[model samples]
Target chain A: MSLDAPTDHTGLRVMGAEECLERLASVPVGRIAFTGNGKVAILPVHHVVKGVDVCFRTSGGSKIEAAADHASVGFEVDSYDPSTRSGWSVTVSGIATVVDDDGLVVELEASDPTPWTMGDRSREVWIRIRTDELSGRELTRT
Target chain B: MSLDAPTDHTGLRVMGAEECLERLASVPVGRIAFTGNGKVAILPVHHVVKGVDVCFRTSGGSKIEAAADHASVGFEVDSYDPSTRSGWSVTVSGIATVVDDDGLVVELEASDPTPWTMGDRSREVWIRIRTDELSGRELTRT
Candidate 1:
């Protein structure tokens, strides 16, 4: 991995696919984009890595309802270091579908997501997206 | 605006139209989503408020190029306070178009952006999205 310092106000580096995915795996927070009422809604989610696909649990409300039709969606994960004035961001674009298998739910229940928000798991819905078409950019303070 | 804490993990707090637009206006940084090569590309942008529309600068590259066809786009601005575990997010979905009017450029140049990223003014392109359709959600930690 290239760890160059950022300079001036214009030091941006492109991150390779593998490096981006690795960084994403380490972080659990990201924004998920989907269509809603002829517009787009971006929501923050706590996600996990299942192979190359990114999975996250959500309640069956607007997000699940809007994405029920398997609409095209985008998932983005990014981390910024303010002290160094550097950061990296990764975006994944794919179709989203609801996962409703009892066996899969059992497996996901065993895994713990580093939750930053407090809430009840009333609506347990899962969203998975393919990671083949992933691209990212990293900015360093040099 | 309802300030009650959300019991569910889903960050769903409805706000008035004016309040929603005000949140989007106050924030200088946001992500812009567009369709590219049959896939969605979400790019972070520094935006300024122009009347009811949101405006931002971009180069004649990936972002501007992909959004040239006036495709359906989504723009989002949000803030999360981990300390209080309270935050809100606003999303705008509309058609995007490239504006090259010098008058508008002069108007935008006079205004200052929050400068959250590092990039030079190599290219000067402006993007505007109508604010007729806007929605938002606020979440308070329980």
Candidate 2:
């Protein structure tokens, strides 16, 4: 180990499932990773948590293409503090699809998941990830 | 189209190749993503931009598994300020491999890319992504 290692002791801890979901709900932004055009690509997106599912807005791109394929995707949210040498990251692996159901769309509408860079909101497509696995890791002071 | 969108005018800017590498080197941390077991996974890692390759250390995990398979990997780094509605993200997609060359290791040693959560640095594996594609986007105030 390099001498530059942090002076205080730290350890990696595995977070419980419920805690992972709670943390996921705490962030409004995260990244979505999907395979499109034979490459695994990732996009940072504005997101909201809805009953164990992740909802995000996109204005039709690789993400929408992947969702059309019913692709398996990974969504991640993290907070890191280099000064304290502590942080937590949560990862959700799930199937991604477009949201077309009116009832669920109305529910999600209240959360107001926003698109980051699109010119038009009316043209946005709502993508939902039906989470199959939820896990997280935290780096904590020992 | 977001009411919450930064009230000040903002636009998405595409970054050129050289500026992307400069920004990549400016930060010591980034996330490496790869396809493993039919799912894309991501890990936050300490990285060094070597010429055009991104080198990070890990004690062997899904990243190693994918590298061993000569898998295409995605490395992403970004910074965003919700208040400014501005930030930038740089992503490198490339084929990943383990670095075992003594000469290159000694050269890479000078930069010292450390593993974040691994216990023993001595057992750390250095994975390099020989970048085939490099692109970046910045959310900028217009």
Candidate 3:
């Protein structure tokens, strides 16, 4: 917290893992970062938090391919209010793997994860991110 | 384009680099994805479009270290409106390097890049991402 800003002007708080996970669950969309084609990539997707896993559906594409390759990934969800100059961001670092367990896939489908994008995504492949570490921070104008 | 949704229900468009750069300029914040400690990391930063480069200021931490190590990075900015289920995202893949030129650093300071977080970041290091490739996609409900 070596911030140069006046202490009275703002506050910075490090949130606990449980609180971070809770914030993640409250958001429907987040960006997933992974390595693909020798480059790091960040793409937005709709995700569902189930137990300790974060799952998202991706049509067989670069993202899915990267997941199948077992890329280390980061998933982030955040919200900011411009007028208030305040926001919180949560990031989960983990290994992303394609979901192939038929029963678990069925369970996820039954849970009704929304793609929220135009496309025939109903039959898209599922990828689950097994969380390894979670960290979050909040910035607020005091 | 392997969408399962009806073609009439949505429209997808690929934007040229110029258009993508335009969208990038309009946004103030984006997520930078890079490899850190053999794991993918994504962190949000306030950035400004500078010529053909994207510039941001980061406190000397993991991100700066990653840049110093010359890791390939992905910088992404996007806007999504839930009401319409539509948005466009632009991703820039490039090598991130620390800005060592004092004159350029002073110019950036005049440009006023916002860190939007807490800390004594005014004298923090500056990182410039030299874009090697730029791509963007738009999803709209027709």
i-RMS for every candidate (Å) is 4.0, 3.5, 3.3
Q: How would you encode candidate 3's per-residue C-alpha lDDT over B1-142 as one tens digit per residue?
A: 4455323223457777888899999877788888877888888887888887898877766455455556689889888887776778898989899889999998998897455766566547788998999988888766
Q: Whole-model Cα lDDT per candidate?
A: 0.69, 0.75, 0.79
- Model 2 chain B weakest lDDT span, ten residues long: B1-10
Candidate 1 or 3, higher TM-score?
A: 3
lDDT of 2 by residue, B1-142 (tens): 3434333212466777998899999876787777877887876777888899998766645445445457788888888887766678888988888888878877787777434564656666678889999988777655
Better of 2 and 3 by lDDT: 3
lDDT of 1 by residue, B1-142 (tens): 3456332345556777788889988766778877666556677777888877888877556455457556678888877765565677788877787776889877887786334554556654677776556877777555
Q: Single out the weakest 10-residue window by summed lDDT for candidate 3 chain A.
A: A1-10
Model 1: clashing residue pairs? A5-A141, A5-A142, A6-A140, A6-A141, A6-A142, A7-A142
TM per candidate comes to 0.80, 0.86, 0.87
Report the Cα lDDT for residue B72, model 3.
88
Q: Model 3: per-residue lDDT, tens digit, A38-117?
A: 88888888788988779987776645545556778998888887667678889999888889899999899888645675
Q: Which ten residues in a row have the lowest lDDT in candidate 1 chain B?
A: B1-10
> After superposition, which runs of candidate 1 have C-alpha atoms over 4 Å from their true positions?
A1-11, A36-38, A68-70, A81-86, A113-122, B1-11, B82-85, B113-122
